[model samples]
Target: MNLRTNFVLGALLLTSGVWSQTGLVPKQFLSLPLGQIGPSGWLSDQLAVQTNGLAGHEHEFYHYVSQTDWVGGNSFYSTLEEAGSYWFNAMVPNGVLANSSVLNQKTSAFLDYVLSHQDSTGWLGPEVNTTKPRYLWGRYPFMFGAIQMVEAHPELTDQVVNALHKFVALANTMLHNGQGQEDWTRVRWPDFIMVLQWLYDFHPNGKEDLLLDTMKQLKFTGAPWEDVFSTELFPKGATDNMRNPTGFVLTWHGVNMAEGLKALPATYRFTHNQSGGLSRIIGILPLMSLFALDLDRASEGWDLLFQYHGRPSGIFAADEYLAGLEAVRGTELCLVVETIGSYLYQVIGDPKYLDRVERIAYNALPATLTGDFWSRQYLQQQNQIAAQNMNPHSRNPFPNDGPYSNVFGLEPNYPCCTVNHPQGWPKFITNSFLTTPDQKSLVQAYLGPFSTRTTLANNNQVSVSVDTLYPFSDTLTTTITAAQAFTYHVRIPSWVSGGTISINGGAAQALSPNNGLQAVSAKAGTTKFVLNLPAKITTGTFQSRPHGSIAVQRGPLHYAFDIPRNSTVLARNAQESRAVDLQFEATAAWQYAIDPSTLKFINSPPQSGALPSPIFDSNLPPLSIEVTACPINWNIAGSTFAASPPQNPACVGAQKTIKLTPYGSTKLRIGEFPVFKST
Candidate 1:
């Protein structure tokens, strides 16, 4: 425990590819604090309570599939299998307290069904007398199942482990047998790679042949998924090699690749195989994809749904696959859940990964959910005014779009999305803490309460206990208990500039500003960290008449100056030099008053040349002659409040007063105002 440096080259860290040699497996997953958690107690409760509904559906769906179709009908089972795996993954930790037996039974039954469907040819899937012959979509069920089984039940039967290996053999053979005619396109290779990582974990023997070779032969450039494999989307036959791949870069590639990249190196270390290097190269594709998209676009490939009338509980939407950001259209549930998974892989090794993840989690995730997590829409528009029907596959409501409806249920727009969304909640909570290979415990996110225990490379035990009302408050107290004195690294949130760190209640000097500060020493028994969050504001853009300007921000929240509704804000000459000047009367916060009636906001700030130059010299009580435009209201997503300036600013000299609040607090108010400033 009395070791100095924890950094080692090529050692396995947490989930991120950076390796650190740890004596014991990591106890916590890395989590990124995206933002605030909306009041979605419903979704949380459902995941906590009614997860069985989805599990049962997966069981029934899988049960109905005949053995003959296991090979051909693999996609159907693969879909159902993923649903079951995610349900089990999300519910298992919590289910241990409630109905552990039922949870295990359902999960075991599903696995049993998958194993039963394994073909004699080592191929795993329902080769039912369907139109298609034996395919590889179903191969992942065994691969992923093997992984979940090994992780969840390390003492799993050798037969079960061997069966999974056989399934991979079948996948490899099936892929090779059909090589003469055409290459497999629709098959998801990443999923295969992920499962292979798991399969190789238990089966360290060199007996696994085709699985390794097939993984090596797989080469996907340009599009994300192999286009030809998806017969469902293109029933006749795939003419082009590209299929519709939907997801933000971080969500699809980052997490998926992180796991593989990290696992490959670890697997290589264990098996002494060079194949791990290949996986690392494959993992770089997503990073490459990020570069492929030009940097200029704000929210580029990541599509946002912007339906006007019908909206979902969440913020962004992408139901119909990468539907560009239209305020009326909606976002996809798949994107939300997948993004969480991706962030988990990114933040473990690097602290900056926390920034992007937190943005998506806090802003994008919570924006869509209703107070409780109960009903979720597949998509939500940014400019959405109210909640409407969310029925799946409904006609887009836009003039060119179809009908809008609430696709709320186990299966909304698509059954797969419904199955995938549940993983986000449980996995997100679990990833709040992570451990490095050096056995250093890192607290990447702040979510409620949790405990983690990890062993360092020296076989020393390290335990971390985090206590705080983080995100809601600025202070975090972390208690580290170690068997021996060891140095641990902790990440500093980007939002925090600098603060005092107290070890065990004693004030320690400020920490460095590197990606992560140097290791903090654990005294004889315990080491504590007390971080004070710095007061700060963030920057954002707002719309004025001619062009938009930047707005100063504090924390995650943005601020705005309250401009009375129905006041017209003009730029005058379309340039800042000739812009409309807004009259600002600072009471508590800045307030702008144009005309009390037909309230509208002026675009330019109250400065010289903002308003028509003549109005400034007039003796008209500074408010009477201000330009008037349509009224605008500032409110949260829903709570409406009047934007009218306080008690007639025109009569201010008549012993009256005007009230105001920060622009961030006011939901609806004029961000830009026009006032004539004397030059």
Candidate 2:
């Protein structure tokens, strides 16, 4: 039979449920549609600040975003397509979550232009000449943004599906013909597969085989992620130490590793064979077994990766490539967001993944961006005490990245992070709450102030609102209104020593959590649930740091010593005051070692009736800890970077009590400190 005839027959079988029973493992929780859940409380305030800052204004001042080919401009950069795609990807979620009409309108217009300009050959985005290979990597982000836009505006669904169908057909042919299967596109094929899977699951339009075939072609031509994870080929240390690392550069790239984490799991969903019923059953056994083994190996690989190179910020060192565990080495902003995306789609449904998500979001994500969101860094260090451009004479910790990588500015070192960082918070907000496959139960997968509306089984409509300052405060209150009774599940973070939940002012019940989730039965009508998670101050050591050095944490938020700073304007746009790049230098001493035992949690009343605007502002953290510290003669590694903490450093000055704020709130801060033991 011809290919078209075979696909038609397969569609018939699928519709008849003959091929519906599959080998894929079901996810414990399914993500809700975009716009169904949104930011509230302090989280909402943060998104508003983003809207008023770089994310909302990039198109106006940033030439990469403003004059890109996607919007009919004549910018002639080879990677302009990727750059424009990144901006649109971030802006869609940010606009929808922030509810900014202006941003939404801009995103809408960009989508309209791209869709309307799709090539006649079923290609999406700008068309390169036939002689030049059309790269597929850029279109992945555009499709991601387009999906979210369609979710938010259902009226555009038909147009989006039509465009996607055409593009997928073209992509399948391209993969077969080796048109755009470059290193990046090959390594990051899971992103494209995910878009294909979305279409297969939601809007197949009776072309399920075509979608599945496209996925298979892409996977066959893609990087060997499963093999990379399953074998010893996975880098156990920094990639630079490996022999001839250039050949394996793409495999060891930090952002690719983050995005590749889910590759095997995603591939398993479509590896099912559908030739004949008995043959399919026989084929499934080996595939399932291989997938199980692959999953375990992938998990172990990740553990080893983190064990050797992980940082306290819930991200591993990767200043473009995989750096080791040194506190001074920088982690890329792209790694932070992509790691969050990987965890969200990991399919294992492990609560620890959610915990990691919160850690990266609350600390590392914000630390890279300015409080006002006007500028950001390509790389951030856990022990960052300054945001100045690196001196040429300095021994660079980030060998793979540029000297200006850690400075806060517009396109400090690369334009990729500038366009890519916007997806961090918006994705967090939307994926905060999830529903079961049955749609009967709601799972509060990640903690934050957000509200959601979902329809449960039996046509039960439910709306849930969470109110509290989480990660900063100990208490969270959830109000649920449902048309019918359903169970509400909340994830109890592993960091909490103990927690209690109360129902509508009734006596509190000690939370008995299973798999890091606490479940409560709610009635058909309105129900109120209050949870108190008392977090204790804790300290831990990093492998690459001095033996006596330690990092502090309370709940999900990391604590850092906020360094006083003087800001210098490195560059600025003449047309806009907020559009400026800045360099920061520590004004006061930063070489202080603290006694961990002296740490005491402190909570201050909100300055006003509500959380402060630009919630991550250096002076506005509502929670802090007081610790006894003493000045020490900590050395500098190079001309600029702080060296490893001295082992049991001697106090050089009289000890004094100092306050440490949340890591996300500080622009220049010390997250890990040396120990100053009293004689």
- TM values, all candidates: 0.58, 0.91
Please give the CA lDDT of all the candidate structures.
Answer: 0.38, 0.78
Tell me how far candidate 2 lies from the true structure as C-alpha RMSD in angstroms. Answer: 5.3
Supply the TM-score for candidate 2: 0.91
> Could you give candidate 2's per-residue lDDT for residues 1-679 as a string of tens digits?
2223333544465457644654344565788888899889888989888888888888776777774443333442233368778888888999888878878888888888777767788876555433545788888988999999888889999999999999888888877676877779878988998898888878989888788778766665566565455334556667676752224358678899888776765765665421223433555432222233234545665676677778777778887778876688889898888877533333666677788778889888998899899989999998887788888877788888778888898888888888888889888887888887777899998887999987888999999999988877888999999999999999999888778999988999999988888998889899999999998888854323534688888898888988999999998877667877889889999999998889999998586646787878687889999999999999888766798888878899999999999888888889888887643
Give the poorly placed runs of model 2, Cα more than 4 Å off: 1-24, 67-80, 128-132, 244-247, 272-293, 342-346, 541-547, 607-609
lDDT: which candidate is best?
2
The alpha-carbon lDDT assigned to residue 473 of candidate 2 equals: 83
RMSD of each: 16.1, 5.3
Q: What's model 2's overall lDDT?
A: 0.78
